[model samples]
Target: MKALFIPGNSPYPIFSHAPLATAVRNAGHQVLMGGIEWVLPNIASVGLPPVKISPVSMEEVGAFMGAMPEDPLDQLKAVGRVYAEIALDSLERLLDLADHWRPDLVVGGGMFYTAPLLAHQLSIPSVRLEWDRIDARMYDPGAESVLAPLLAELGLDRVPEPDLWLDVCPPSLRPADPVPARTMRWIPGNPQRPLEPWMYTKGDRPRVYITAGTRLFSGDALRDMARSIAGLGVEVVVGAPENVAAELRDQLPDVRIGWVPLDVLAPTCDVIMHHGGGGTDMTALNAGVPQLVAHPEYPTEATRRITEFGAALLVDSGGQEAVTEACRKLLDDSSYRERARSLAREFTELPPPAEIVADLEQLVAARA
Candidate 1:
């Protein structure tokens, strides 16, 4: 089978789809990445080479997010309008790629990358790929629910028949609030991150991992956190990307700072610090370490939500004082470590990635 995959908005695609692509490729299918042209660095950052197909420029979507008048509702309305425009642009590109790749089916992870619309335009089946509960149920009446009705009004069908709305989030993680059942499915994700060296080789002192990712990687806060923790006599392994690490490293020269892989670094560390991307949350849980999170909500929605569940610490990840205090508290508290381990056990109980992939493949086959 050949598939053209439309990716999510954030860097999640790199970790999420990059591994998924490798697995699908190993399964004997050709997969073409379709969202790279819009967010090129995101593709390049994750080390995925350019795919043959080009995506509609994300400039309009960026502009749309930029030009929206501050209100959340207005921003959402703007998104749906811009979604239509972007979908049209994506359709033109997909049509051109189809003429070349001629994929067996088209699959997208998350919204409006034009997969469903593209499939609609090309008379082929398409599935909306969901990674978070928010995107999975964003169409209902609650916070962040606006896209479905708006899309319906625009005459674009958001629903896929024969039960096609699907998600990668595990059902055990679903909220108590009512959720849409038809379009949802449990799909576990693992990027198979290369484990870092320091993890397997334990040091005399306990280990702590720190990263705010891109959303709220305040240089000052990170440096203070490092300095505060470095003095605690524990070995701190930070996997901060180049941009975030530069300033933090300058402040905490004593701390071991480098681009250690998460899969490798996470399991080694006794605890972690991150802004809470879903992938990061899962990684930390799987590694069975305590987490300290600090995100200010724009791109931090995933972080903030995960924090509310009590699985990790919602450290302010902001001011020097907040970072310092949060780190010290988590380091000293035994309860935080206990909760983290419990969450890791639940994450472990979830279905493996292969079963999740089979669910999606089955959905597509059943549709056909």
Candidate 2:
């Protein structure tokens, strides 16, 4: 069987889908991942062969994010429309590839709107892989609004749902209202660097790993938080791109700053402080490390759940002080680590990615 994986034009979406793509390929199925030029390197880095679709520039994605409203629901709606636009922009090239490639199944990241539309057009089964524990179906109404005209042109009323949903969120941390989904264990797909002894092994003092995610952060705020956290007698490690790491290193001489792999460093840490990106959040969750999220955006279902579950803390309003305080609380409290470890256990117990390859094959066969 041949499977086509479509990731949104960014690194994180591709990171979430890499484990499953690799799984399907290992199971002797042909796999191909498609995206704009920007994400081709990312796809290649994850050991998947990349097929270039149409272009959606980073500037466009930045503009869409910049235009998002303050309200969470409004933001969700806006994101939905933005992705719908991405689908429309890329669908022509995608269809052209589908005609040539003729994949038996389409596997897509949650926000890759092209997945369902392509599957629908080709009459193939589509599988949607959720990055974390949020209600992805919330984007449907907004997506449908933008896609309505396009659907009419195609002689369809609505975009069809994927035949399957692979949920990576642990059962305990799942949102109260979740779309019907099959559970899959979360796997860390972070990019790797040469491992140092300290990265894989724990030190004597409490270790805190801080990252700003792939995009968007305040250097001054991160520097302050790292310095302040260090003052409390804990080891602080910051993972970032080289340019940012150079800047951060100039500001803080004592802390470790570089591109440290989260999968290797996470287990050695007592706490992880990051911007509330889903990939980073899940990576920490998988490591069973308590979290301190200091993003400006309002809490989503995943963040709210972990915070409520006592495995993490949120710093929405306060600047560095609030973040430092949250980090302190997470580090000082034993309960937080206990809860995080418990959730990690739950996450590990869910089905592995390889188990789903057979299921996907069955879905394709059933359709035939």
Candidate 3:
């Protein structure tokens, strides 16, 4: 059977979908991943056949969405609208591809609204893959509000719910009321580079890995955080995109600044500090590294759950003192590491991607 996988426009969510898509394809079924031009490289990196469904990049959509609001609710609304706009822009091309490809199933990333619409239009099953522990449906109200007209245009009242929702969140970090989903282990599929000795090996000093994620962060803030982390007598490795790494090269002569793959770097680190993007957060958690998240509550549910689980701490500001104190606390207090390792153990107990694929086949066969 043929399966079409549609992930979010951004690189992180696309990475989140890779493990399962690869699993399905390895099971001797055809898999085609659809994305915008901006994320084609990310799709290709996962060794999947990519079909570019839209010329627009996520940066263009972010420009359309304008400034992100400080209020988390408004931020969710804005994010919802952004995904809706992406769907609106790509729907035609997506439908055209669907007509030609005729996939028996469509597996969508958590926030990619277009996947459900495509499945509904084609009368096929759609599966929703959670990018993290959070229930992504929290953005639905905002998305559906903007999507109403398009729904009317398509003669549908609402986007159909997926036949299966795969949850990759560890049970310990899951929200009190999560969407009903099948538990699947989150196998990190972070893009890799040729590894050097430093990446895979740990030094005598405690090692800390800091990343702002693909969404990017101000170099000044990252520099301050790096310095603060370094002051604690730990080795600091700053993982960033090329541009950010270039900006930091001279400023942080003593620190390691480059694209260090999380799957490789995270295991060696004593602690992880990042912007709290779902992929980064889950990666460190899976690696059993205690985290120092910069935001107080952006990805609401996951942020709240992780802190409450005592695996991570929230740094309210980018102040150097705050960064140092948080990192020090994560390093000094052993409980955080214990909790993180507990979550990592939970991940091992969950079903692997291949098992999820077998279950998916059964679901599809029953429907057929």
Error in Å for residue 45 of model 2: 1.1
The clash count of every prediction, one per candidate, is: 4, 0, 0
Per-residue lDDT over 150-172 for candidate 1, one digit per residue giving the tens place of the 0 to 100 score: 45664765534313445444444
Task: Show the lowest summed lDDT stretch of 10 residues, model 2.
Answer: 212-221
lDDT of each: 0.59, 0.84, 0.84
lDDT of each residue in 188-215, candidate 2, tens digit only: 9877767789889889999988886533
CA lDDT for candidate 2:
0.84
Identify the leading candidate in terms of TM-score: 3
TM-score of candidate 2 versus the correct structure, residues matched by position: 0.94
TM-score of each: 0.75, 0.94, 0.94
Clashing pairs in 2: none
Deviation from native of the Cα of residue 336 in model 1, angstroms: 2.6
Consecutive 10-residue window with the lowest summed lDDT within model 3: 212-221
Report each candidate's C-alpha RMSD, comma-separated, in the order given: 4.9, 2.0, 2.0
